[model samples]
Target: MKCIVGLGNPGKRYKDTRHNVGFMAIDELIRRNHWELDKSKFNGNYTVEHIGNEKVILLQPQTFMNLSGESIKPLMNYYNIDVEDVLVIYDDLDLPAGKIRLRQKGGHGGHNGIRSTIDHLGTKEFKRIRIGVGRPVKPIPVVDYVLGNFSEEEQADIAISIKNSADACEMWLKKPFLEVMNEYNS
Candidate 1:
């Protein structure tokens, strides 16, 4: 079994913010798969479904961005899931809008959600899918930038990125992470 955890703050207030892109990708995945996330457990919402004969769990952490691990760790523990079988999806400021990158493992790179996951999981060996939200062009504070909504043009790009990120998640279910990375990273 593999678990895909999307990191973001919960509630409608943050539903469309830049920091919630992870949630957006997960939303896309849920929609494309027609999976019903009607169940609640492990400090978030989740649903299990088979994809290409593999049981896959889709999770959206409700512990908010900084406390993401609080949701992920418990679920992983209950399911006996290995770090290698987990794919964390979140936003990245290092790349431009509409871009995505996958990695086998790495440090959080200043993302509160990833940092929290690393802390709770006790390892950075898990896989990750990063959707590029881009850094602020001017002098806005990082917090403000990440929590802010996208511009009209950026909204279009982010919509595409969200769909592509979901596609990357589907690819990971059937292919090796490295293979998916090679195919999607550029």
Candidate 2:
């Protein structure tokens, strides 16, 4: 089994914020598969579905960003999924807006969501897909910038990135993750 987790703060208030790009990508995947996150448990909303013979779980932790692991770890344990079979999607401030990067393992890079995940999972070896929202060009605080909505100029790029992220996820169910990374990382 494989688990795909999207990190974000839940509720309508954060729906369109830059920090919620991970949720956006997951929404795109749910749309494509005609799936709904109908089950709620372990502080997350999730769905179990088969994708080309692979049993996959799509999860959106309702525990908010900084406490994302509070939701992920329990669900993973309940499903008997290993660290290697988990893929976490979240926003990244280091890369330019709309850019996406995939990695087999890495540090949290100061992301509290990832930090919590690492702490709860007791490992830093899970896969990740980072959707870049870019750093604030203005003098605003980092938190404010991440919580803010994207500018009009970034809308197109954001849309493309979300689409690409969803596509890559579907591809992962069929092909090797390395191949999907090579194909999308370009």
Candidate 3:
């Protein structure tokens, strides 16, 4: 089984924020596949289902955004899953809204949640599906902007991106990464 983790903070206050895009994608996947996210003792919620022959664990870390690894590591250790099978879904301030990038490995690129996952996992060699949230035109407080709600103009694009992200997750679960990138990222 593979663990596909959507990193974000919990609660309604963060429900529609840019930082919670990961959560949004998970919501889409569950809605599309009729998967149930039941609470577990691992400081997160998980759902089990099959994507072809592969059993997937859909996860939403409850350790909040910053300390996401705290929830991820325990479940991974318990399942004894390889670091390579972990797929991380997160927001990317580097790309435009509605854009999605699927990469095999790289740096955290200043995302604290991703950084924590890398630290806990001891490698950056896992799959990452980064959905663009875009950057502010003028400089703004990082935390404020990331945790902030989307503007009216950004709403449509964000909605499109969330669905596209779910598609990307499904592609990753089925096809090889390079083929998924060729089909989706291009």
TM-score of 2: 0.98
For each candidate, what TM-score against the reference?
0.97, 0.98, 0.96
What local lDDT does model 2 show for residue 62? 96
lDDT of 1 by residue, 1-186 (tens): 999988888898889999999999889988887887776998999998899889999999899899999999999999899889999999999989989888999999999899999999999999998999999999999999999999898988999999888998998889988999999986
How many backbone clashes are present in model 3?
A: 0
lDDT on C-alpha atoms for all candidate structures: 0.91, 0.94, 0.89
Across 1-186, the per-residue lDDT of candidate 2 in tens digits comes to 999998999999999999999899889999988999999999999999999989999999999999999999999999999999999999999988889999999999999999999999999999999999999998999999999999999999999999988898888889889998999998
What clash pairs does model 3 have? none
Worst 10 residues of 1 by lDDT: 30-39
Tens digit of lDDT per residue, candidate 3, span 68-171?
98888899998888888888999999989888888989999999999999899889898988999999877899789989999998999999988988898888
Error of 3 at 64 (Å): 1.1
On lDDT, the stronger of 1 and 3 is 1
Question: Which candidate model has the greater lDDT, 1 or 2?
Answer: 2
Ranking of candidates on lDDT, top first: 2, 1, 3
RMSD of each: 0.8, 0.6, 1.1
Candidate 1 regions off by >4 Å?
Answer: none
